[model samples]
Target: MAWLLVLQGCAGWQSALDPKGPAAGELAWLIWFFTGLCAVVWVLVMVALVAPLMMRSPARSEPLALDAGAEHRKVRLVVTAVGVTALILVGLTLLSFFANRTLAAIGSDAALTIRVTGHQWWWEVRYEAAQPSRILTTANEIHIPAGEPVRLVLTSTDVIHSFWVPSIAGKLDLIPGYVNVLDIKADKPGVYRGQCAEFCGAQHANMGTFIIAEPRPQFDGWLNDQLRAAAAPTSADAKAGADLFLKRACVMCHRIGGTVAGGTVAPDLTHIASRQTLAAGTLTMSRGNLAAWIADPQGIKPGSHMPVVDLDGDELNAIVAYLEGLK
Candidate 1:
């Protein structure tokens, strides 16, 4: 029953055991194979230890002689066991080498490449395109086509971070001034959760993102939509909020498409409302949450790069109204 509970805990959307891609599937097989092999070895050792006790006689009086033949047999047995253990080790090593080769072969002909830059607590996602005009930039959400391999070029702008989506691929480090490429794919259309595996800073636990896999056509449509400029404010309150956003310090750290706010220190706010979460999964996307975050960012996520903005109730509401319409 205890073992059953442990196994059940391993099952989840973000678990490596619940593999959804070729790389993860291969790794899962290796894990099971190694575990089973170790179990068999453990049983054999237990039996060997108990067999001597079971064959002993408690009342024996005579001392057993260590004959030449008995000594030779014991030596042979030890040599054979050592040879078998060595062979098993070599076989497992070869298996791992072949599995790594197979993982490397995937995404060789990838149709998409995304440059993912790691910040202190968020992900800066940029879809590379041959035509500069076709490039798309977003934050915290990665969209890819199901059944097709995609390449991720990873780098860090600040401290080192690890990009890990356990269901799709293994963890890879994003070092400063160095680029590492990770290939991943999704076997089906689903949302897979990911997080920064490395301990970067105070908010490392909250540095989460989502991998959204869809059909090719659907992914293309979404990409096209993201490439367009931010929508214009239509309501009077939203317009006032937009003006306030530009007038205040909000324009110094975030970017809004087709607007003057082009700061690159933080996540882009071009489609902030469209995202499912805010502050790197700190809060769900909503008006109240947005207002709270803008009003007291330190209260929501302490040590975050975003500072608290001073605004009255009317200005705060207008700003929230404007940001909510950005999508």
Candidate 2:
């Protein structure tokens, strides 16, 4: 009971009861209504059980004959109760159907569409644009304008994964070779946390992302910035780091715009430093974290695709410096 009270008080970015969008809000209401109704039914059952126990008496010495009138009354009472129960169940079923329809009605006129591809441990996000040149690609983080509908087309390249942001939308599966569309919106500007609701692999629990809802102008500004190429390194150390990155095994699995590293097997590092977190929310984005990840990725996330780079201290520092300047 105490835990239930604590759960009821949850209003964080990951809580369904603290919904910030139309779909989640409707779902929250439905959940509460169903929960309340179930509680009422449970209480009635408990009372019925306890009432007979509290009124229990010793058995009579002689067997008594059945009263026909009382038996008919009991039969009528049982029939009425069964009918009421059936009516309640049918009403709840219709209510659920209507709620599902309401959820389906949202985002029919979405102005933007994003393609999210699920990997074993990370998310590949692509914001589609009318012009090919205007398309923006990033990973682990999504940005959208508040008060506008956006559709997400989800698919998995390897195994099954589920995209879930409890505060804004419900869980939807991303099956291999199948595209599933989920629409979401935010009523206000805020950051909402999400994770892979399916168990895909060893690092499935670590596969997380964030949705940043901002004003229209701010969202547009962010989109414009993301569409640009990676920033050129200005310092000598950064330039050296960039050289080391290209010379090492990094270029085989990662891509940096305007560079020769054109690997598509990993997350794009074009503007990696601009993101809030790294390694699909495993660590905060920083030079030290980047150096550690490069040096020993298996130590950070076991069974991850990122291999440990056998580089000297100086080489590792230089590489981290270069990647950190990508913003």
TM-score per model over all chains: 0.93, 0.93
lDDT per residue (tens digit) for residues 20-131 in model 1: 8898899889999999998998998898789878885456365674468868987997899899899999999999999999889888999999999999889999999999
Q: Rate residue 84 of model 1 by lDDT.
A: 85
Between which residue pairs do clashes occur in model 2?
Answer: none
Give the Å shift of residue 71 in candidate 1. Answer: 2.7
Tens digits of per-residue lDDT for model 2, 289-318? 788888888988899999888899888877
**Residue pairs clashing, model 1:** none
